[model samples]
Target: MTEDAWVPLALSSMIEVGTSAGAVVQGQEIVVWRDSSGVAHTWEDRCPHRGMKMSFGFVRGDHIACLYHGWEYDQAGQCRYIPAHPQLEVPKTICVKTWAVAEAAGMIWVALGAVPPPPAEAEVTALRSLYLDAPLAAVLAALPEGFGGTLAGQVPLVTLDTDLGTLRIGVQPIDARRTALHLTVAGPATPDTLLALATRSDAFRLSLETAGAAA
Candidate 1:
């Protein structure tokens, strides 16, 4: 959130070429996608025109076309073309807000501010990522033990021992029922296996949520 460290938003493999996806980062709805040339970009989900969520739009090579009005936006969040105008150059005000993005450790990293610190070397080999429906406090409390020590290296981490490897889960709570958990391993794990490992997190989250509701 400080724009000093790269927060793992989603797995890189999750966004295939020409595919667009959404995630909640820094408490904002972000849409990220890869261009035809395999470049990645991140932007706020709201379209500047009608405030419609841009994630519902379609991808056309390097731009995403909004579903509401077919507004085309490039990776820089600029409105490049409007099917309605066809001739008018989009005003500079009609651009989607963009964030700094980086792909490392098989994950998509988004920096909220300019000049964010570079992502660590280990994050480049992450195994997988998952989401939780509980607050980060609940998620950390539910960890078996010694799963993670610090978060964001200083934010406090809740490390879990999984069959696949040492599962290091970073919890970013968006709301009561939406938390993005980035799963990294200190050992080897295939993408397939890592996806499977995410299932086990369900039990932990369920227990934490249930107990928290009761309390």
Candidate 2:
């Protein structure tokens, strides 16, 4: 067993009740989704059979049925039905791996290893999250200390910012050269302003990279 942490997976809006957010945490492919009952669930992205992606499967209330074979699994990642073998209790080997998951501040956080307690949301106001092509370092640099202290309303961050020792930024790798930076601004503001800042910063990052490439 290794030391584990619960990383913010996605913004609440990105994952609808019937949709899933695909992420790779600590090198493990994971799919976090919400069922029809309004509960969030996390499981390995791969199916036990034929390595089909379970994230593509459809949700039926509390169960997730594989899209390819219609095999169903429960919240506990237990294989509930085989479709073909409707009356038989599927063995454990047929189940997909799962982990403890919870929602915090309108976003879902999933632990990769021994999961910690669900994140408590007290002052953390749900702010919009975005996908950035740049790395976390670049994203932080672009911000003016949380964008010139704009995040006054957000609190008790779902993610722990180890670098700043204050608010945390949830950073996920999209590729060797790119990362998705999910950051929470302090609180309420003009959505138009926030969007403009994000957009401009992204454009600047692209320009910087292009300049670097030409050198």
Q: How close is candidate 1 to the true structure, as a TM-score?
A: 0.82
Model 1 regions lying over 4 Å from their true place? 1-4, 123-128, 145-153, 156-164, 190-196
Least accurate stretch of 10 residues (summed lDDT) in model 2?
149-158
Tens-place lDDT digits, model 1, residues 1-215:
43455666677777888888877754678888788899888889888889888888889988999889999988788999999999998898899988888876556777776756565545434654656666666666556532323333333234555555665555555655566777677757677775665555555556666776887
Estimate TM-scores for all models: 0.82, 0.75
- lDDT by residue for model 2 (23-59), tens: 7654578888888888888889987877888888888
Name the weakest run of 10 consecutive residues (lDDT summed) in model 1: 147-156
Clash-forming residue pairs, model 2: 144-148, 151-186, 152-186, 153-186, 154-186, 161-168
Give model 2's TM-score versus the native structure. Answer: 0.75
Please list the C-alpha lDDT of all candidates, in the order they appear. 0.70, 0.64
